[model samples]
Target chain A: QQPVQSPQAVILREGEDAVINCSSSKALYSVHWYRQKHGEAPVFLMILLKGGEQKGHEKISASFNEKKQQSSLYLTASQLSYSGTYFCGTERGRQGGSEKLVFGKGTKLTVNP
Target chain B: DARVTQTPRHKVTEMGQEVTMRCQPILGHNTVFWYRQTMMQGLELLAYFRNRAPLDDSGMPKDRFSAEMPDATLATLKIQPSEPRDSAVYFCASGLRGNEQFFGPGTRLTVL
Candidate 1:
């Protein structure tokens, strides 16, 4: 099943911080975070593997909670370029080292200078 | 950097016509996925293939849409007798198992 994202939309100042949450009912082996600008394709940000690993890219970080079946993305000291829609993709179990991903509806974020 | 490439970045066609979108997955990325995006549905997975073999197409509309990986490097999604409701941005992504996906600049299809 596709995960559910909270705070469908958020607005933040350029230097502020924001958090986006994604929750799934089923177990997820991996969770991926991506950002998409309007009229553009989504760009991969980071990936959080199972076992509650934390992955960070620049000021963007994410944590995966295996027991809770949830993941959260943290944007610290956001920049104007961070204004975009954020999506979380989750995969069930690994299948021969490959698995299909289900994506959430995405959280729209806007950063104002 | 090798990235997923999609053809016909923008297309506008009349209803009932046929539309075809193609993708070239990244080298050695065994998993390929096709997704449709719109304001209402956000992003919906249409189909996927692993190692050139179809894994799941349950999200696709079998009646009018068909997805196939004719070869390891290429994946295609086709819609016959297209309707206005099929208008959306279609994205193609490729990745290794349990890793970050690389997305192509999607094909924007508009069915009038």
Candidate 2:
């Protein structure tokens, strides 16, 4: 099943902060975050595996709560380049099986100068 | 500069026509995934292959959609008698098991 994302859209100014949350009904073994610019392919941001690992990339960071099957992506001091649609893909099952990613509906974010 | 490559970035066809999209995964990538994106559905996984073998295709419309990987580096998705509803952006992503996936630019399909 597809994951659910909160705050369908958000608008922020430069130097602001925003949080996007993704929740899955099924247990997740890993959570992958991606950003898609307008008229472009989705770019890999970071991946958070089970065991509550938090990852940071530049001003963007994410936290995974394995127990709750939820993940949150944080954009701090947002820059103009941060404007895009964010998607979270959830993977379920153990290692070595048909591990496919089920993506969320996506959160549209706009950042102004 | 390793990346996934897809052919025919844009396609426009009439209903009941056949559409074929192709993908060439990055070197040494073992898994390839096909996805469809629409305004309403977001990103939906259509099919995926691991090591040139189909692993899952439950998300695809079996009646009109077919996916195949004839070689280690190539994957194809075909739609026969395509309908307007099939108009959407199709993406191909390749990765190793349990690794980050690299996505292609996508094929924008328009069926009129």
Candidate 3:
């Protein structure tokens, strides 16, 4: 099943901050995050693995709660360029050890100037 | 600055037609993934390949949709007898590991 993202959409001003959450009903092996601007492809941000280290890039920080089967993305000092849709893809344990990713509906974030 | 590339950024076809979308994965990447995006359903995984071998395609409709990876660098998704409902954006992604995937610009499909 696909993960669920909260706050379907959010609007923020430049320099503001926002947090997007993702939750899965089943146990997630890992969570992958991406950002996609209007008419563009989804760009990889980072990944959080179960029992693994959390990662960050630039001003973006993310955390994964293995116990809660949830992940949250934190965007600090949001810029106009941060206006886009954020997607969280949850990976499930496969039969043959292959990885399959299921993406959420996406959280559309709009940062205005 | 390696990135996945998809061909025919846009494709328009009528119902009962065949639509084939191609993808060229980043060099040395052993995994390729295909996805379809629609307004209602969001992003759906159609299929993926590991080492040119199909890993899973249960998300794809076996009857009309087929995905194949000809080699390490190439992948293809074909829809036969496509209907208007099939119109949406298709994305191809590649990755060396399941931890992250690099997506292509995507192919916007419109079935009239």
RMSD vs true structure, all candidates: 1.7, 1.3, 1.2
Expressed as tens digits, the lDDT of each residue in A59-112 for candidate 2 is 568889999999999899999999999999999975657788999989999999
Error of 2 at A7 (Å): 0.9
Docking class of 3: high
The per-model DockQ list reads 0.74, 0.90, 0.85
Minimum summed lDDT over a 10-residue window in model 2 chain B is located at B93-102
Identify the runs in model 2 with alpha carbons over 4 angstroms from their true place: A53-59
Deviation in angstroms for B61 in model 3? 0.6
* Model 1 steric clash pairs: none
The DockQ leader among the candidates is 2
**Interface C-alpha root-mean-square deviation, candidates in order:** 1.5, 0.6, 1.0
lDDT of 2 by residue, B52-74 (tens): 98989999999999999989888
Off by over 4 Å in 3: none
Better of 1 and 3 by lDDT: 3
How large an RMSD does model 2 have?
A: 1.3
- Taking all chains together, each candidate's TM-score versus the true structure is 0.93, 0.96, 0.96
**Rounded to one decimal, what is candidate 2's iRMSD?**
0.6
Sort the candidates on lDDT, descending order: 2, 3, 1
